[model samples]
Target: MAEPFSIKNKLTLMTEPAAAGHRMILSGISLRTGGTSRAPFASLNLGLHVGDDRENVVANRRKAAEEIGFSLERWVCAQQVHGTNIARVTGECAGAGATSPDTAVKNVDGLFTTEPDLLLALCFADCVPVYFYSKQPAAVGLMHCGWRGTVRLGAVRMVETMCRTLDLVPEDIYAVIGPAIAGADYEVDQTVIDEVSKLGRGIRNGAVTPHGDEHYLLDLQALNRAVLIRAGVPQEQIQVTGYKTSVFPELFYSYRKDHGRTGRMMGFIGMKNKGEGTS
Candidate 1:
């Protein structure tokens, strides 16, 4: 397969740009670099709830937005409760959680829209960020899925909402599974395995592998791909990035690797509504 994502630079892995200019949609995940925060949650930490200084986090966000070509004023963030709940927002919902967590979309793990210039963003350390796009309707979606959100059918709901609410056709959609903790670095016990087993034999067989006594390695990206495939998206249309958070400490912040005190990387998807940026 080809590279799952591209970037204007090494700091942000962006989507394919418009052939000549910034007239098209933009989507990408921010690498854990180019920011102002201190260690542990060191530099480029975009999440507000991770105990980083508020000013530093906001400054980091401003830097990210400038680099990503999306204005913070038009960005909508989620509180991300790790549930399957998702919200579809428009331009008016911009900057909801750009600087603070309290104003973000409540309890939603996902966000999507057909609206232009309205960036939907969610933060991650080791959790999965799922991207969905339909060119026909010009729609894009983003979701935050960890173990809890995965088992709760977060991706499935995003697909359903697109088809039902946005009138998109499943076969016409493309999905990109972003970086997260790889199976080799993520070990789980019986309870987690049992929860995954409920997903069905096909996914369980490929996603869960025995690592040791009563322990299994869980592949979150693979699991989300399977879920999207089962939800009617074509398997071939989905692209999974090999970039693993736990494996690449230099490019990403790994929650498991850092032992619960790490920064976050933001995954964003949106179109530019004819603005002063994105050249």
Candidate 2:
């Protein structure tokens, strides 16, 4: 019920409210705002590997960067292998995956960077967008958490990596569990349920419920929240958005709802450079 993501311009951009004196721009862009891709991908499709036109994907990425007041060359991304691999990015890694998927940081689902003016991005449809920010160290990270990544404690890994790499404490880190398919809309097999249960009994209790034989409704957001808490992030410092991608097809691209033939929305976070303004 907590609407942590505030819609700024219909579906173009939704940002987290400024809190704890931290003003890093954390956004989950929608599928309706920009881009030149065709149907299924439609418009505003930032992902290049989703069968959308490569040229359109490039155009869309450039448009997104321009809208955020950064050049496409400053955007950094990953291949998102649905694993727990975390990549520590620096200014030297700028434009790694900006224009082409092959140039993306290989085999990583999470990206952490202290460098300013560089956007950390991950593509998602139903997978959760886990965001991390540390005020003292002035760093930001973006993570892609699908079912596989969630079971592997991707959020926990990201937080731990940030704390170790940035020399910050978990209590000072602010995390946001971004939009994804809600439990009511996400049904999983017994194997997934068992895997998630490995997190602990407490995490398995309300996080998943039996739907039918060998099926359960899984709450990935809740599971990720528990993971963050167990990883030492304070409950008060974490924000979970209520938007469900599958339930809101008009404003988001839903892999499940669209039968896996859909586009992807991007989760982006970065610290602005000196004298740069948020639009």
Candidate 3:
């Protein structure tokens, strides 16, 4: 495997280093106080549609928004279906896709905006959260990359979409691969192993196991970074937060670690002028 990339966060919020002029904050609420009491849902569960208590999830999202200086009323998120569709944001369409006080967006995994006031966020649990930013064009984007999204090269596609639709150049973009299931803890079936191995760029020697039918540990973060590189984003421009969501249950939620019934964490990206900004 390549050298591991780590996501550096500021204060207690979960932020990624790869994205500049933006923040990738993650929530740290616990299950007992903030999460649903369902056995699988546990605590701090923010997914309202996942059978968690609606009131608690709403409260949690509001608290998170306040902490990050964004209005929950203005934040927009798509109903994620793991497809590669990327939506462009505008002032007239602000808060157009949010589902409820606890849910938003109907079927998009990628969100991009040059609109300064609209905050875009995606919910994650063991899925790789990717953040995007550009200095010259002055825009930011965020994406949720599960294994399906990564295998589909969603990270690379997001960069390309920005370049094609938003007039962003690859060299000016900074991509950060946020926390997810790392290679060591991410064991996959033979089919997945073979598919990733064919990618040729991310598969490391001994990353796969030959015993009992070829199970392998897939490195989603590294593979996603490879996709960004292939899309023309420089290696240094790609900041990786190799934090394992499964490893930090206290600070973030993990679907696999908590057995598919855990709370969610939010990864956000927004652009603000350096000297003159809105609070």
Candidate 2 matches the true fold with a TM-score of 0.94
Alpha-carbon shift of residue 21 in model 3 (angstroms) = 8.8
TM of each candidate vs. truth: 0.95, 0.94, 0.83
Q: Which residue pairs of candidate 1 clash?
A: none
Maximum-TM-score candidate: 1
Q: By the TM-score metric, which is better: model 1 or model 2?
A: 1
- Candidate 3 lDDT over 147-194, as tens digits, reads 778777788788998898767689978777777876777778877766
Cα lDDT of model 1 by residue, 1-279, tens digit: 777776577568886743113336678899888888999888889989989999999998888888887778888999888899888898789889998899998888899887777889999989999988887677888989999889888988899988888777788778889999998889999999999999999988989999889999999999999999999999988989988999989999999999999999999988765454562
The 10 consecutive residues of candidate 3 with the worst lDDT sum are 23-32
- CA deviation > 4 Å runs, candidate 3: 1-12, 16-42, 97-103, 201-212, 275-279
lDDT of 2 by residue, 1-279 (tens): 366776766345566534323445555555555567789887788888899989998888877776666678888989989999999999888998889999999999999987777888889999999988887767888889999999999999998898887788889788888889978999999999889988899988959999989999999999999989988999998989888898877778889988989898888887774445753
List lDDT for all candidates, in order: 0.86, 0.83, 0.67
Point out the higher-scoring one by TM-score: 1 or 3: 1
What ranking of all candidate models by lDDT puts the best one first?
A: 1, 2, 3
